[model samples]
Target: MARTGSGTGSGTLLCRRNIKLDSFLKRNTERAVYERIRTYEPCVVISETINKVYMHVVLSDERVYLTEYPPRALTIAFSFRRVRDIELVNDLPDFLSGKDRELCQHIRITYLTEKPAAKGRDWLRRDKREGLPPAAPPSRRNSHSPTIIRTSEGYPAHRVQGEGGTEEVHMLPPTRSASWPNPESLGLLKVPHPPARPPSKPPSLYSLSSSPSISPSPSDQRLNIGESAQVPRRMGSVLSRLLRRDGGSSREERQAELHLYAVSRTSRLYLHLQSSWNSYIIRSTLSLDPLYRRRCSVLSDSTPDKRLPSISLERTAHLFGQLSAELLQEEISVESLYLLLQELRTAAHRNVALRRLFWRSSEVCVFLVQTLEESLHGCQSLSGGYTADQLLLSTLIVQTLAVMFRETEVEAARHILLSAKKGALASRMLLALICDPELQTENQGSLADCELQALLADYLDAACSLLFEMLLLGQEASRCSPAENCVSIGWILRVIQPHPHLLDFLSYQAQHVVLVLSDLQESCLSPAQCVLLFQRCRLLLACLQYNSQLAQHLRSHFREEFRYSVKLSCAEEKLPLQYPISQPTLRLVEQILTLHRKLHTNTRALTSEKGL
Candidate 1:
């Protein structure tokens, strides 16, 4: 019996050991298999790693998507049944190419077909699912014990373990998205930082127990960048459509619309510029850029070949078209025209090389002149309402002309005086006012018409008078070279012959006398070469036969000078005189007196030799 007992004991011990060893081996084998299976399971790549795959387990997603299939939620459950121990997910991905490996590391997929369990709507609530066990009912707890608020739920909704561990706190966020009040109405909101520790005394409702709420200050608040400005915009209706591309707009199909948009924008810019009158707008609003300049240069009959497809100036003929369209309306203002001239003058002054610009550049001068000419012409015409713009422009243009042409260095005054073959408009306006006793002959504003004379007379006289101070002023005023002066003077003299009554055009009574005297004086101012001046003046004076009284008055006025001139002529001839000194030039006054005395005595002899 002792022997059998010993044998039984050994068997029993051995069986126990065997059972334990089997359990151990099974556990090890299972762990090894789990590790291997984990390699094949789907995972996500949290970051790039040489030989590792890190992923976040997405439990569920409520976001709706417009697509064929609902996205599968991922979980951390894994198994390693197929192979021995494996360390990381990426190490096994060596068999995969770049994209496959990326896919393997960046996606979550379940290997098993079993669907994931879904949580109920109370998933976010703490009371039923995440809270501690409920406190004992009143019957179960003694009233004396502190009222422990134990909840029947499983675990605490929020718990802090250590620095590395945290728990979620459930509370309302200050701003609940778009439903929140406007940041502006709230006024300069300030965010308060949380205290280091909660107050010993529980905070009042006003005191903050939780993290401080953050509110951006007024300045820091986001601006609605693309919203309409405070002043409501007057949007042009989209009666037209334009092509769009890549969440933007396209101009290809909407050519007309695009052009319209451009025109509107440009027109608006012009109006804005006009209204604001800012220098920056003036400088950059319209570029003296090629387009504007070319538009200015466009001519009515411009040829396509000669036209630059896009240049800054226009052909001279088309200048009228290119002016700021706003200015072309029924009533152009004096202020506007003055401003325009300022712009032109500014451009000319600023550009030193304007001549190279050719035809268009010349148009600047032509444009200005024509505008002034037309405006005045218009104001004087029967049709125009006689706006003062023309008169104002005239004033400005005259001043501009003086400034612009003063540098020419040419002495054109003499040429001007001599070229009065019907006279320039400026000259005519002056003369018509002077001679027309009623002056109502037509189209003459006494104000504008008469002012021209005062300006020219004063201007010429002042210039000549200044020369007198310089000691170069001659009694008659002709320092001009005969060569050039003759061209203009000959015309003046010739015009008078064909148009005998041209003298009526002189602006002042004194102008006529001055004209005659001027001719004589210029001849004397430059004696030798201008000798023809005297001859011309003499012939012109002789043409005043119908105005004999006026002619005789002139002769009497220069009587002493005339007497000396004739006597000297006769002396030079050294000839005996047959008649009196007053007959004509080249006659001696002395001979006239002597002949009168002799005629008185000889009258008795034969009723006077003169009577014969």
Candidate 2:
């Protein structure tokens, strides 16, 4: 009996050792399987903290997993459906320092790109299918229960699942669950069906459910066994609609409610190191900005400089040609053109050399002239006048050109404009735009349409400024010959005679000229400066010869300033003239005075004729 007992003990010990070996092998097998799965999955190491805690970001086909390494205690999961945008940033945060600062690049992840799915009739139906108590029949259910309406085909229209060949439909009320009430109990009558017509298409399952015309009643409709068989045919269609509505959420709403997350610098470095550790395991999901990358590379290779990097002349010409081609073909959108012009304006405003380069392109110059002419005609076109976008675009174009011309040598700039093809047509268009009576009308429209009117005013101002610059150039060109000045002066006189608005524009310009003269008189003058003043005076006198009212207005308002400037200018040059005005200037002023007297005489004669 003792030997038998010892043998039993040895057998029990061997059995226990075998069980322990099996448990050890099972654990190792599970670990090996887990490691294999992780190797195939796409992973991104976000960061390793100073505490030696590592954060691992893993991207699956439809979800993202974030987990803490070592302890593996914390985990967060996100659905890809919620991801809106992913942006890579090179800028590091200021707070990070040392190893953490050197390790990571920034990544911005945007979420909540769509609205959350609402728990509606589908959810209730799902709950009922998943072992919940069956809902009572429509006839016996409380008034608070959803109403089930029947379609013409006698199928319940609500989105309820069929059980044992029985389908039920329930209507989704407008209000929340607690406030639900029978729509028919509110005294609503059943909607009459339209006249029966030939079936043009297969009937939709949700058609009766969504129809506002249908009203539920106490009478419950049950599908016959034959009708229940047809329910399966519509199930496919119903599920497809649901899937599409859920999966393809509207991007507009997502864009309106996007959220962004920026990973720290250390996290970025960790991601970089992790990617390098296993290139195939962790690949970038977002594309890098080529322009930004190129800029960074260039900066790193070159010496640091505070000044903004200058665009090459070749690049400027290429861009100008592209813009010109787009404008000529009318292929570019107004917004796109405006944006491009804005960039050009900013560049030209900052760099004088860029403006010079722009003018040197003959194609660009011609394009500018053509664009101005088209914009002017588009604004004034009687049928289908320019849209708000086009109006704003025209204003931007004019503003950009004005910026290019501003503070530059007037003679050179004018030469560039005149030398281009259709340049003369551009000037004529500017004059016509300034004289257009419609542009001078008071703003009259709803605030929505007022933007176009405001842009119209800005366009007119820009046009006037550009035209004045051109005229100044003309004045410079005609300085050597008084006769040459008549051609331009005569053209101006003829253009203004028919348009009182043009006369007003000239008067406004005359005020600016007087102010400039006043400023020049206060400062010591160079001979060249004195010559420019003389030319300005000559141009003003020529304009005054056209309108008696304008001439009188200038004389009354600026008589002292004008006289003082003339005397100062003549004295500075010591001109061979006793009169304050030079001979050419005096001749121009005398002609203006004669025109004013004749205008007065004509007015008096008209008044006498009316009295008779």
Candidate 3:
């Protein structure tokens, strides 16, 4: 079959046909503009301590444009999610600026009903359908707007009779009212061009401003009497509907609720969120460590700069304490908290001003332990389905404790001793996590199951660092008074040794300790760090005591760890031995153990030997 007309022809009034489509678009755009003009939605307001969010109202799937004048060099388009509090209400002039209100007024013209081409419902039938336009004022509401006011100029004069038998007639003024469309005529069908972008403002505007006629009536629904009246082509322009509640459970409702939440930021929950975020920041960046002065406590007599980075620890603790209370009551956002913490930690590390946070990592760790334990006490879990982040936090905290002890060893040991019961908890959590690791470790198509290689590596590094910090810097002489650490180390090792092949678990430990001899060779070692390594060497030598020797290759392999431990331990050094522990080596080991024992027994008297 041959096609007739593709909306084009010589005798074709294509523009007239297209005009209806444009008219529909033009009407809807006006309603949208009128809606905007009448309502207001405030974006930023003080909620919690301080929070700001924006609000937006979507009208019939229209394309919006926003251009940045400064052409911000960085950001592309901003993304807005359905935030959790904000709103847009229909009180147009109430929320917008004077200029915006003026712009919105232009909408009333195009929004109302259009004039009928022919009378009767049959006008919408068949061949006329192709040339047919939007149905005329079949709906009563369309008769009230500006178009009716314009066509009224050609109508019969209003008939009136005076009390004294005198007759009078009058012509009405043009109305400036929002083009009200018949509620019934809306029919739920969407048009292409929205009432958001009114193109032309016809006439001097309707004079129906003060007393707007909103309700429908029987006389208003009648067919045109004689001369044709231009029907206002309205697109259901009911401004109040946009602002009023449409009952419940729609996507818009949810989005609006979220927006409102964002706007009203001062709730207790938001405060708690901010505090929680701060705590995470501390952990991610700052590697826990004793004070530099703690490092100097051996030579405490020599240096004297003790002023720390001015963070209010007491305040932070109080805040976290409150947060923990709220968080503990429910199965809270554990994973999100964990991720936020990680990011904050990273940020803190990159900025040195944040390093003092590390000095206070001990306090942060304590707060974390307290919060988690409290939360977990009565809080329920999904049978055996434990949280990956919770376990990660435990492991990370342990690693932090280990490093904090690097300078002042006794503090670490003291912490372990004090938290013995909790340390037990840590062990349990960590073992469980290892049972089913979380991080991705493979690059495969399905990507469903893989090792958490990166996380594993970090955990091990932390463990090794902690162990080293404890054995070396932590002794009878150091500030790491947590003696439980030394006792727990052997137990923890035995427990973990079973999974020794778990991503070079034992090898890192083995490699680090055996490399101690060369680390002892460092002449500029801090006596505490040096002796820490030396004593660690002795323990490592003990681990390798079965059938091993601290050879050059072994020493070179863990050069950094060995050097760190020895410098931290501040132990006396012996000449290099290109030999494994033969019988002679046994004697050497014996001598080293005696010195190590002296370290365990009388830590203070040997302070003079730290820098050597």
Candidate 4:
């Protein structure tokens, strides 16, 4: 009978006073229900009653508890699962006293009942006593029609007293007369009447008879049963047809076609990039920068005053539309489009400012994924199934998923994979890329070698970047609780655990980064491509040294590579880049290498201590 404080430990106790009673009881009831039902927590507490004050408690999770307190405390529980219906009664009959009437705000709950008669009985039986009655001839005018039976109050009977060589026939819509049918007369047993419909709704067309408890008039009987049945059928057919028409039965197919067209459209424009330089406008006039590149690639939304550009799916579509028209008149390079897409993909992956822009305009990401999926599938099929284009697109999808996952949007990430029917398709591409031999590409000539190695490197870089993001997400969990950290770290481990080759590939990529950085000293890369390669290397080195799981595995699986990374991390100098690197890029590389050294030193010390 004693009630404690609010379940939230808020110190407030529920009061029974009239002024606060209803709200108090409602809130407490909701708390109680939520505590009871953990899996399917109640969505909302729709209605509650406390008129009798101790009569009942309704909680949001569809449980009702009746309680009595003070004198003899008792509790009874009922769930919504057994309930047939709930009705709110606001009116009181004239016979009720004022106080009783005022307390009539209680709800009426009905539970489903098991009716015995409904399951076990054959309600009607035909009497069989043969060879006794003599036949009576029918009258001339009524010979073709069946005999009609009527009782005194104009109710119809199933049969009348008539002489004939009798035969029993079961009939439809058995008549109910002034009195219920008896076993002696027709071998009929009593059955309970069906529940009546609420008076507010119009009569149902599918109900057993058109009129209720009354025989149809002569004129009404003239309308045939077929006509009545067809009325409802026709109405249903029309409604279904309208729904199908409005929803467009070919919606999915049409969407695929549109997505394909968009990809094809972009492809045509991009192919113009490889064309003769004189065919188009020069690069100086265009804003060819990847949007928010530096801000997004780094983990900082550090600048409060910076305004990140807002790009939506609709805006991207509109831009494509305008540009496509311009491509007809003058040459526009595909690099601009690629840079925007790259920026968009980056923005979707990192820092809150760009992420907010992405979430505000989600459809653009959706369309981008769809276009990529369709385009990648087409490229795979046309190129006999393992093209650079296909592998690149698959990596883009994984990159997009990583971004969504980083934002803690697991469902959004799942949807993008499933939505295009490319969930398995992307997996196949990744698997093929992994298992495909590198032996053939080496012999294909320098042009082919550079192209294939670059593509493979990009793919590996993307995979490593996703792993880094996953570890970053785990780091974010430290702000919450130890349990959250376990879950976050566990998720990262589980994801990478399946792809052991991913770890192997990252190990290879780390070594390749060392080579690429050495190559950057001699070979000139476009600024954008150069920036991307540096970022990839930084991410690879950072993830290898910092992520406990990856770092542990790397040290075991690729010991020599791990030792080299440690040496690079510990060395008190920078690997010089002869091909003048930008100040920002140089600074980022130094920061990453410094971080790697610090993390590696700490981890090595921890390992030695653990061993001791």
Candidate 5:
């Protein structure tokens, strides 16, 4: 019996050892599996806790994962692409304890999802059939305890830990270094060495010498030099201490530090304001107003033009499209953007002389038009009364289109007009405003009509001024080599000729051309050249006499104007009143005189025919 008992005991001991070995192998296998899976699905550990804690924070390229390992592991991954906002709240007082006390810090992340989970509803239901014990109700004692709050798929929710929690913290592998000291301790106790005792002064044999002397001595006088220098040093030291609590720093350095702090504070405030504005824009774009609407008006009371309001500039950008995109992206402010537009508009108005005004106005208008088009494209679902900025944009578009038409960019004007909501009406209004005053002689105009006329005239003057430059170039070219086949005069003549149905905008410009020629005859051209030019001018006059108004204007004013110019050139040359002209020029002059007489006679006959 003793032998049997001994064998059975040995077998029982073996069985116990085998059971323990199996358990140890199983635990090791579970750990190895975890490491293998993590290696395959690579992720960077941002932070971790090693006290058998349930929560883990991991960062991947596109998402941040927060995993809870309560009995079983479950993860909630938030993609950065869907993350709308991220905020770090530090030193938050424990709020649920019915007291305003700072308790801990937390990271608050707001993200968007296509299918959001229903609020206040648990994802998991308790299975009583599994025979699991019910979770204890949370109380004040366990408010911040490492207890499972909720469970999903048999895994517990993350336990909220505090800064004072007894958990071993670890940083990401890339950021970790063995050389770095642990930062878990709240305070460090620096061991101090004992101070050495000062030697006792020998019983003063000269008590009088130890006492401070009031009388001036040679040695004391020498020390005064050192003491005088030390006075300023003390004052400087005190001033430096007042400015900076540590080492001596100059006033400039102190000021620079202050300025740096101010700049940093300003930048932080700006970022916060921008984030809030972005949230507002997102809501506005969606036409969902959970909060009260923000009614920001960008109008300035000190605007120079009463007809147009100044847009407050809140951002700087190279292009309006870029500015608009920045505004949508919360990278720039509306005030800066609008202020730039206003300044450009003011400059354009000031320079209404055609060349400068044309380029400036075109630049401003094109920018405004592009911005408006983009805004319209993004405004499909939005519905609300237009803001001041929106109205300002609309007004700018209208003004720009008006300027385009007045400057004879009719095709561009038509294209832009067609893209607007009330394009036809705008086109008609612009046309009426720019129509020749000669065509509206009897009617007294309204204020808007008068304003329109002024705008049109300014634009026309700019257009006509461009023609002046062309004429000046032609005159210069002609003078350089009059014998060369000059096509400039021919081109201008062809372009300026009046047509019955088409409106003539170049009548005034043609008169201006004659004036330019007269100026050229006096200053830039020789007597022979002037006579040659005069001959060409006379021929041009005859061809243009088909128009009764041009014919009458030339006969009454311009013919005399050229004649006086030619006579002045003769006087300047100190020549006889009648000089022998070249055969070609002389023949041209004679033909012009003949044509003038014939045209006048035909005019009389035509008038009589009409009367009959």
Candidate 6:
């Protein structure tokens, strides 16, 4: 009995071991099969956990696969060829109930008229070298000998004479084959056949010679000839299909579209997640703790990196589209609009390409004009309807426009601004903002909050800078057209007449001009800095030419500073100046001083006559 019991126990253990071994082998075989399949096919795998549910998504060239784990185990696959549309669902569907409905974010895919099953794994293996037939061996024939064979339809054919006097003939189709010249006419030698064992490296399409060759038979001698003939056809078909699949768009365009889609989706996800977290905190005990709130605020207010974030051209276009769409809506979120404008301002300031794109967008230009009009109306209202947020938003808009105009070519900027529907209205609104008594430098000290005062000052600076560009454009336009000169100059004169503070502000900006000119004389400056200084000088010259009183004010109050700046600018270079750029700047400064003196003298003479 003991012996029988031992034998039975040993058998049981053996059976268990066999079963475990079989299972292990099966798992490894499955893994190896999957890895082999993935080797030949390019795919993107994304692992995400949404609403406590883990999901895996696989994207292949032709199809999409989605798998959900655990309690809600589901797997779905669909081909891109069958997809009619893909929609991003922000709100919960009716079928999703309870917790699922509240937390789920899903993609809704619509299928075409006939939805077919996705292609098998073998489809991806088509490009593999192992799937291709081996190349045939070349026939043993005299180098000078040529044999011509004809098909039943009388079309010309090529014949390869093999060993044992067995001849194989390849018929050339009459229509397309005529384009290929006879091998003998080209004076080409026969290609050597591949060896019995296939080469480790795959054959390249370009390796095939242009001469006509025989098709392969069941025998190995003709294999290479067949492969060379078929490779070009197969490659051509593959490329055509890829081009068609992309719907005539280039690869770069498709990539840009995908990038924009990914960015928008990620932004939505982040916003949703942040909102959910905030709501959870509000419902929990953390909301009531002042210390926690303060800590959160401190973290939020921590200094960010000073370097600007890198942005692509596609992202800038996407931002412009979003802003235009939002502005077109009847009701827009102030915070969201401000954030978008802030991002655009940063992008425009950092990227010259983005600035040009921004200026070229006529829709954006019109929308900006409309926004300025609304802000102007609010500011001019009797009820004091312009809020701090509106002021900030306007400042961001002006700053972005100022950067665009400053960096872009003057003619392009002028043309774009004038082409907009309400272009002139923008200038009027800008003047109103710049001339607002509440935002004047003199009134800045009355504000208790220094930050608010600083913000107003920045807004004033941007407004003044943009207005100056517009005035330059108007001056050029005046030289060309008498009517435009009358309109632009008349409106500017009318606006300036009502607000003498505008002249004071111009005088204040002249201080910066003095400092920049003095710095230019003391040390070498970059070409860009020199250009900026030249622009400032031109603006000062225009101010002097336009108003004799302002020139008199400068001569009386700031005469010594002006004289010193002019003297420093005229002195021979201590440090070498960037030629051409700095030379023009120096010449402009001399012109400005000459004009200032002439205007100041004329004003004094006119004042003496008035006293008499």
- Output the number of the lDDT-best candidate: 6
Off by over 4 Å in 2: 1-306, 311-315, 318-330, 379-387, 407-426, 432-445, 482-501, 504-542, 545-612
Report the C-alpha lDDT of model 6 over 1-612, residue by residue, as the tens digit. Answer: 000112321221111122332232223222211111110111111111011112233232223333221001111233333333344445433333566445444443433322122223213222344231111112221111112223355433221111111112222234533323222211112343232333245422111111101111121122222122222223334222322343333222110000001211111222222222222222122223454333222111111232112233465556556665765666777777776666565445333445556655666766666776566444543444334565677777776666555323222433435633434644554455454435423334555446555665666666665665555444434333343233243345445555646665666567767766564546655433444455566667765666555556667777777766556434335213423334445656777778767766776799999999
- Local error of candidate 2 at residue 25 (angstroms): 87
The residue-by-residue lDDT of candidate 2 on 303-377, one tens digit each, is 213212334345554655565566556577666766667666555544344555565555565666566657765
Q: Candidate 5 at residue 202, lDDT? A: 29
Clashes of each: 25, 5, 80, 1, 13, 5
Worst 10-residue lDDT window for candidate 6 reads: 253-262
lDDT string for model 5 (1-612, tens) is: 000112321221111122332232233222211111110111111111211133444222122333333111112233333444444434322222232223222333444433222234222213323322222222223222232233434433332121111112222123543222121211111222233232244211111111011122222222222122121222323222221331233222100000000011101211222222222222222222211111212122233122121111111112333423433444345576655444433332221122122333334444444555444223422332223344344344443433233212111222223223423332222222221322232233967446545554444443332333233223222322223313233333333443331134434433433544444434443333333243334434534543555555555554554445433333333322223222223334445445556666776798999999
**True-structure lDDT of candidate 2:** 0.37
- What is the lDDT for 342 in model 4? 56
Q: Order the candidates by TM-score, highest first — what do you get?
A: 6, 2, 4, 3, 1, 5
RMSD of 2: 33.9
Candidate 1 regions with alpha-carbon error over 4 angstroms: 1-334, 342-361, 381-389, 410-487, 492-612
> Tell me, what's the RMSD of every candidate?
47.4, 33.9, 33.4, 32.3, 37.8, 30.5
Q: Which number leads on TM-score?
A: 6
The TM-score that candidate 5 achieves is 0.20
How would you order the candidates by lDDT, starting with the best? 6, 2, 4, 5, 3, 1
lDDT of 4 by residue, 1-612 (tens): 112222321111111122232333333322222222111101101111111122223221223332222111112233333333333434432223456434323233433322111122222213333222211122221111122222343423221110110111212223632222221222112223233333343321111121111122122221121122121223323222322333333321100000000011101111111110101111110112344233333211233123133233344444434433442333334445444455555444332223323433445445544545454444444334346665666566556544444322212222233223423423332332232223234246677567766776666556554554444434333223432123243444544445535565655755655554442234444443444444455455555544677666655554544335433332212332322223334454555456555666887899899999
In candidate 5, stretches whose alpha carbon ends up further than 4 angstroms from where it belongs are: 1-442, 445-455, 469-504, 509-557, 560-612
Q: What TM-score, computed on C-alpha atoms, does each candidate reach?
A: 0.21, 0.33, 0.26, 0.32, 0.20, 0.40
